[model samples]
Target: MDLQQMRYVVAVAETNSFTRAAERCLVVQSALSHQIARLERELGARLFERTSRRVRLTPAGMAFLPAARQCLDAAERAAAEVAAAVGEVRGRLAVGLIPTVAAADIPGALLGYRRKYPHVRISLRVGASEDLVEQVKQGSLDVAFLGLPPTMRPEGVAAHELARDRLVAVVAPDHPLADEPAVSLRRLSSETFVDFPAGTAGRIQSDLAFSAAGLSRDVAFEVTTADYVTRLVGPGLGVAMLPSAFAPQLTGVVTIEVTDAPTRVEYIIWSRFGHTPAAAAFLKALDIT
Candidate 1:
């Protein structure tokens, strides 16, 4: 099958809806369906089981999916190598950034890269570190800035350390624990806490620290952004544990070091293979080998 047909199949598999897949692929539904039908005819098997309510991949489709992805990846890598040979770094670069770690010169680095390679198109996605890492692993993102706990290591990706920051507790200035030089994890077990959502890197580190101290915290508020957590704590809503880099300078909030808190290591991560020339240029701009 042609690369276009393979792309259509992959899109349909990912979206699980021919109509939505067509929309994503920027083609009409009939055209996409025709391609898939042609592909299935050539293979002599049904790739997807279609129903009124949903679409599911058949056994043949499941078996073909990985090979299809590999083929596409290889084609892209070959194109990138060609572009590199010609000394051209012009292509779409999809990069993911974690909000908590986005402040650590990543934006500046991207700006410089854009200035140096104006023809290169860049798309930036902001999300939780775990989600961003997943995007990188899935090949949707060329690279990602992630905040990882020291105890948690990523697999199947190349991680370059960007920065290391400690986790700290934030509270209202008049709060009972605001004056403390440092707070232990066990001391905040009973405190009402504002925190990042579950499964995020920040939340994972906080959970692990509490669990390690044999203490549990009552998370009264959960937000997706560290800035919002800081704002919430500023209004005396509750205390929060966030990366020290995200500690805000708001009027009512005070940051206290967590004596036993986990270290949040920021990393620039990419897939082990198939990075585009633009991605490599961006990494070079960031001083990553």
Candidate 2:
């Protein structure tokens, strides 16, 4: 019924444990439980189903959660706006990025943003492209960096296109294909591959390219992080196709230009409604708008 009660509910839902939620909110478990119980009584609905081992949101809780999150966001945005009026940007900035983000220098950008806006608190998460986009749209993240096939664009949000590049094949130094300056999707398709899991945005770019060429790849190793792919390929276990911008950063792999490769477009996305003061300044710091 109140913001504090809603915060407790949100925390409990996210952490999936009353004890952990209490720790996150810097309160004791009993007080947090009492507040949520009081709120549930006021709302005439049970928000969570509790058990000895686990906590799960009830139907009513799931229904209440989105509005509760929006209310919280509104309250935070109001305070941020007041600070903005005084030419100060002090608030939480939650940023999400794909691990292979190449269009912008993420760590360097955060360093500069921190130096310029010392009052703001910042947090970062690395996730899949689609997951980051959804987090930005859901109000969990203020901004995100994403990369997808050039044919697609993030829907229902405001995004700035950062750059685009074709993917390159990476192989070990003594691998048969390593000496080649250039290869084709078809050529790479014949080798064992290490790649992101199937159906992920990063994985799909290569999947579609080979599918279109009427070829199939043998993805022997499925790993989430690009660094893992590099490690796998470094031992001559399998080959990987990575973004041109990203491939040069690795030391063990030899980058061979793919004659016919999938093109990926990088973007910076934020809410379409408006930017929070911290997000606005951060984007502006990068000359995005």
Candidate 3:
């Protein structure tokens, strides 16, 4: 019935626990529960099914969540628009990026944005390129930095190219390829490898190149984080191919050029139609059109 009550319900649905939702909403458990109970009574539906160990949304809650989120977004957007009309940028800015992103100094950029727009709320999420792009498209993230193969493009979002670079092979010091000045995919394919999980944007870059060369390699370890990939490679267990710019940042590994290396492109993506004032201002401040 009221925004506050709706917020409590939404928080409970998201967190899946009344106690956690209360903490997120900055209210006591009893008050949040009472408000949501009153709202449920007014609507003639039970929103959540509570158990001793967990909470789950009921059918009615599932149907109500989307509309509740839309209402909250609309209210926030209205206030942001009013502030924009007054030459002020004040709203939430949720940014997402891959952990291996090096196209921009994300931390420094966030620091600058915070300094310039002290009234805005800023949050960051480090995740996979695909997940980050999807988050931006869904409007949960105001902006995202992504890395994908040159042949790929993010669908249903506005993106700007940041930088492009070829990949290099990383090997442990005692590995056979470490002493080599350069190597080919056919050579590296014969050795076991450490790489991102198959089918991910990070792994696909190398896969495409090997496929183009009519070669297949074994990924002995498939890890989500680049640091883990490097850590595995450092033990002489396997080799990896990583962005040329990012390879130098990791130690205990020798970086070697690949004759037919795959190229990766970095991009910054945002919602085409759902740009919050804070997102717009942050982009403008960074000279990203």
Specify the highest-TM-score model's number.
Answer: 3
lDDT at residue 34 of model 1 (Cα atoms): 99
Mind giving the per-residue lDDT tens digits that candidate 3 earns over 73-113?
88998999999999998989999998788888899999999
lDDT of 1 by residue, 1-289 (tens): 8999999999999999999999999999999999999999999999999999999899999999988988887787687678779987776689998777744576777788888888777899989887887889888899998888888877679988877888888899889998999988888788999988887777898888888878888998999877788788987899987777766534468989888887778888998865778888888777788
Q: List the residue pairs that clash in candidate 3.
A: none
lDDT by residue (tens digit), candidate 2, 1-289 = 7899889999999999999999999999999999999998999999999999999999999999999998998888899899999999988899999988898899999999999999899999999999988888888899999999987899989999999999999999999988888998877878999999998999999999999999998998999999999999999999998999987688888999998889999999999988899999999999989
In model 2, which runs have C-alpha deviations exceeding 4 angstroms?
A: none
Choose the strongest candidate by lDDT: 2
Winner on lDDT (2 vs 3): 2
Mark the regions of model 1 whose C-alpha exceeds 4 Å error after superposition: 52-54, 127-138, 172-186, 197-200, 208-216, 220-224, 231-235, 249-253, 258-261
TM-score of 2: 0.92
lDDT (Cα) of model 1: 0.85
Q: Model 2, poorest ten-residue lDDT window?
A: 181-190
C-alpha lDDT of residue 183 in model 3: 98
RMSD of each: 3.4, 1.9, 1.3
Candidate 2: residue pairs that collide? none
| lDDT on C-alpha atoms for all candidate structures | 0.85, 0.92, 0.92
Error of 3 at 249 (Å): 1.7
